[model samples]
Target: MSPSETPEVVLHDLRAGDGLPLVLVHGFPLDHRMWDEVARFLPDGLAVVAPDAPGFGDALLTESEPSIEGIADAVAEALAARGVERAVVAGMSMGGYVALALAERHPGLVAALGLVDTKSVADAPEARDNRLRIADEAERTGSVAPVRGMREALLGETSRATRPDLVAEVGAWIEEQRPEAVAWAQRAMASRPDRTAVLAAYGGPVSVVVGVEDELTPIEQAEHLVESSHDASEAALVLVPDAGHLAAVEEPEHVAGALARLHARVTR
Candidate 1:
């Protein structure tokens, strides 16, 4: 893709009376497909928009290095391009970072907010360096190996022990991604700044979902979001049992239920 061009997004049934527009942003190493299960249980009237980030899923990597804020801006542009001026914007993990950036940079475009399995703080020094290391390894290998093990690490203990099919499915998704995309995501995440203030400033209703067993971004992270977002008129924090970082995939029904509630808040 060109340096200035934004990745295009697929839209679903935004016709009149289709209800509020919603955009679901995917996390790192995964694509729009990650939300397949959650979308199934969302309120029926939503005009859903799910887009692969710049380099994950079937999208191509750009010549320029991708930034979370840049990706958020691109998503905003993409939505406007699709005749959507505003929508309920939600994301998971890296996508949550992008969602926060979007609200920071283009608050007018976000009618409501949903943050799933994500945090508002920037990576610590060691974590940031590790991400850079992984990015370097991925670029050198020209493969997603550097992040392949995350498929297991991302799951909760219960999932790792009992959900072989889920593990295999996550592994398959990770393998399909290109090394460039992985590197791009790592670079973007490594340099991200704390977004607690963004969440604290947001005026819309908010939803925060995380697996109770999610070690990566734990329940504390979810609570921090709720505590920091006192400005939001409403906030819902959901903990999915027996799931992990990939709660939306590990236990779709629970994740879907959280999103359904967010949709209700948006329309209420």
Candidate 2:
């Protein structure tokens, strides 16, 4: 996509505070509402901007190719629209792909990074093929039912066993997504490149967060991220006990605290 063809991004701006802006990018097949729980616990004097990635939420992707780079460009444009020169970028799951893309494509715009329940490596061949299959199913059915099987995989054993209400809430969010959007997001994630180099090159404060019980993008992924950074000593890794893939929702207070610490470190 060319500069002229870039689509306008939909932003959920809570411009209620000061300090450096914190931009939150939600995961695939989900909207900015994914950050609702975590956002409430953020420290005062920090501006928060959560944007809907293209083809997800109310945002539409104008580009024919639904690449993660395209989503990153949209995020950069969204920040520009808000007059934000630089900000800490936090992303969960597929949102992590877009965050890494943003850091790689628009390095100057990212002041810091908060990666939650995500990995720096690209999808394996089998994973890519599976994603394509899921996308195809979604397109064929005109429904997100194809991916609903992942609901249990997205949460921890504890969450599944104890917090049925939270699990149901997450399922509801997943069910509300548009099939086309889900397909587009799957394709984008499938095509993403290994972004460990981006972390190795980034100089800002980095926060690597993951749920201890997360079946997908587990603790090892978070550790790898911290270890791969330019200065491993500077990176902060936080593990949320009994949480799963959706760490932000499962343990909002912990996620928010990690973010707040990262923000403080960056500002200091």
| Clashing pairs counted in every model | 0, 1
lDDT of each: 0.85, 0.87
The residue pairs in collision within model 2 are 18-45
- Provide C-alpha RMSD values for all models, in order: 2.2, 1.7
Give the best candidate by lDDT: 2
lDDT score for candidate 2 against the true structure: 0.87
Q: Residue by residue across 35-135, what tens digits does model 2's lDDT show?
A: 98888999877788899877677787565576888788988987787788788999998888888888899999998998999999998999999999999
Best by TM-score: 2
Which regions of candidate 1 deviate over 4 angstroms?
Answer: 1-17
